[model samples]
Target: MIDTAASLSRFKRKTPRRVIWKRQGLAFLFLAPGLILFLLMIWYPTVQTVLFSFQNVGLTGSKGWVGLNNFDRMFGDPQFIIAWRNSIVFVLLSLIMGLAVPIVLALMINEMRRFASVFQLIVYLPALIPSAVGLLIWRLIYQPEQTGILNSMLKLVGLPPQLWLSDPNLAKPLIIVIMTWLSAGGSTLIYLSALREIPVEFLEAAELDGFSPFQRVWYVVLPLISSRIQIMLVLQIIIVAQVFTEPFILTQGGPASATMTPVLEIYNAAFVNSDFGLASAWSVSMLVVLSIFSVIYVWLRREDTGMN
Candidate 1:
């Protein structure tokens, strides 16, 4: 019989270096298109934005050096300050809704034996709708006049119809509620998947040990899925920090700019005000803040994991 292992070793030893070079080069050739497109579409614009933030960009396509003037103006503007503060509030409201609700819903769905798939489908149905469509749906439901769904319900109940999203105090929270309804389903599905991944043997062992249901989840299930939870939390922060479309499409940062957010301000600066440099400054500030916060969060998680 031929020695297959020795024959393979001999073949490997006999292979020419040019063949190896050709194979490696082919791999790089496949990667080249993606790399080139990324540079052109994403990376090049980012670099341009950062560089542009330092200059005075004019309506006539003129540009001049303006050392920190953009940043100074951004800080001094009251609307800019309101937008930044609102952005922070937006982040907090997202965490408040995003953290516990999805996890609880996932746990409930996981425990359900009958109708589990039906329940999952219901929860995730909103996520299937495009975000813009979802927002528009909510806008119609929350429309100020008595024609709105909620207002009509109040009319039936003999309760006076009141402003929903138009109310300043209610606007931000209501928008967050809309986002939570749309997004929580996706997060719940992710958590449900994580729960499904738990070993059957581990649960069996926990049961045999006389551990109660909550005990098993608290000690075994939660620790197993903790990493996913942390990741979701971090993602929520990053996403909410740049929230634009919710306020943009629904409220237009309205009710005295109560719902104003940094990204919306950036939009107004660039398009509405035609101040490209100021818009670039806002973009750079968001990048810097988010980058710093992400680094700190990862470091803390690493320390908790004893990988620091």
Candidate 2:
């Protein structure tokens, strides 16, 4: 009897251990592919870029160690300053235009009882289009001549045709506009989803309390969706800070580097100038800035949530 009881107790303990081991093994098995891909695609490249930043890497291969020389050259370059300034401007503009517009649009759409689905599809259509294709289309619209869509519209209104992408003063704003148009749809959808998550009873109660449309949105809607707004704000900042394709396609950081962004400068350093080391250094600098931004965003989010 004593031997049987001891055997039963051992089996009970061993069974749980065996089950836990099996479950953990399955979890690791499921995670293995993603882990391998992350290491290969993200981790390896990041490590390589940091390593190459300290060394002179040429088109052929590794050249020689250059220590901080690449970073010094990058900081000293006038175009680098221009790129960084432009990146900051772009991020701020995106926050103002890109973030606010979508929220407003989403709020308006959420109020619509009829044709909501149609409105959603229409708004989201641009987001579904390939970014490269949309940029090319916008390029045609932004052409400086009278044949351009925007120029033609301006001419129809008896306004003088202006160089949209070629003018140094206009290029960056045009880029921001195009970016907002392209990106607003998806953000609007996200905002709409968050709006749906709000309790209908709260909205109704506010309405009964004589809350105006604007007041309801400002007080009730904004607070409930503030988390999503913060998330989107951070995402927009990261994206706009690293903007490359619009400037690359529309202006090529041209018209006296007006549209030049840090990422654009990095691309020019690597491919155009064949200075991989300098490019890697620029990349590392950008990474550091983004990391700092992310940390600050997290801290702010924690504080906001704690206060709530």
Candidate 3:
């Protein structure tokens, strides 16, 4: 009887160890593909970019080590300065237009008692469409010709057709508008999801305290959703700073380079200009600048995770 009891205890211990080993093996099997892709697609390129930024990488291959010269050139270039200025402007405009639209829409949508799903579908439709198609649609609407939609409206008012994308002053703002329209839908859904998670009693409590509707939103709702807003603000800055598609498809950084951005400049340096060395330098510079915002975003999310 004693021997049998000892055998049973040993079997129990060994069974749990085998089960744990099997679970770990399964976990690693599921993780292996993602790890391989990350190393190949993301990590490898990043390492190459860092290495190439310091060296003189020609079209064929690396020429030699030329430390700090690329950085100096990037700083000295006139177009690069314009690119940075434009990137800053993009961030500012996105904060004003891109960031607020979603929050406002989410707030309005949250108050709905009926047909909310219909409104959500309508709002999110723009995002569901391909970004290229959305930009192209705007391109047609903003066409500088008299036959174009906006120009046709102007013609009806006995006004001359204005150069929309070709006007240096108008180019950046117009592109920003397109970006806002395209992005607002997706962002609204995010904020709406956050709004839905708020407890009902909180709003009721605010009303009982005799807070007005505006006060309820401003004080109660905004405070509750501030975490989402904070994280989105950083993300918006990061996205706008590296804006490529809007300018690339619509203006191609034209209208006297009014819509020129850092990413666009990097692209032009690599392919259009055939100067891979300069392109790598530009990429590194953008990485450094944008990494500040990235770190802020990560830290904010980490705080959120910890709170949860």
What lDDT score belongs to each candidate, Candidate 1 first?
Answer: 0.90, 0.89, 0.90
lDDT of 2 by residue, 1-308 (tens): 99999999999989999999999999999999999999999999999999999999989988999889998998899888898999998888787767898999998898889988889888998987888899999999898987888889998999999998999988888888989889899999999999999999999999999999889989998999998888888878888899999999888998988988889888888999898999999999999899887876777678657853
How many steric overlaps does candidate 3 have? 0
Candidate 1 backbone collisions, by pair = none
Tens-place lDDT digits, model 1, residues 169-194: 99999999999998889999999999
* Model 2: residues with Cα > 4 Å off, grouped in runs: 1-23, 296-308
Give the per-residue lDDT of model 3 (tens digit) for 1-308.
99999999999989999999999999999999999999999999888887888888878889998898878889899998899999999889888878889999998888887978888888998887888999988999999977889999998999989999999998888988998888899999999999999899999999999999999999999999998999999999988898999999999999888999989988988888777788999999898998899989988999657853
Off by over 4 Å in 1: 1-17, 58-62, 293-308
Off by over 4 Å in 3: 1-27, 303-308
Q: After superposition, how far is residue 92 of candidate 3 from its true place, in Å?
A: 0.2
What TM-scores do the predictions have? 0.86, 0.90, 0.89
Best by lDDT: 3
Ranking by TM-score: 2, 3, 1
Which one wins by TM-score: 1 or 2?
A: 2
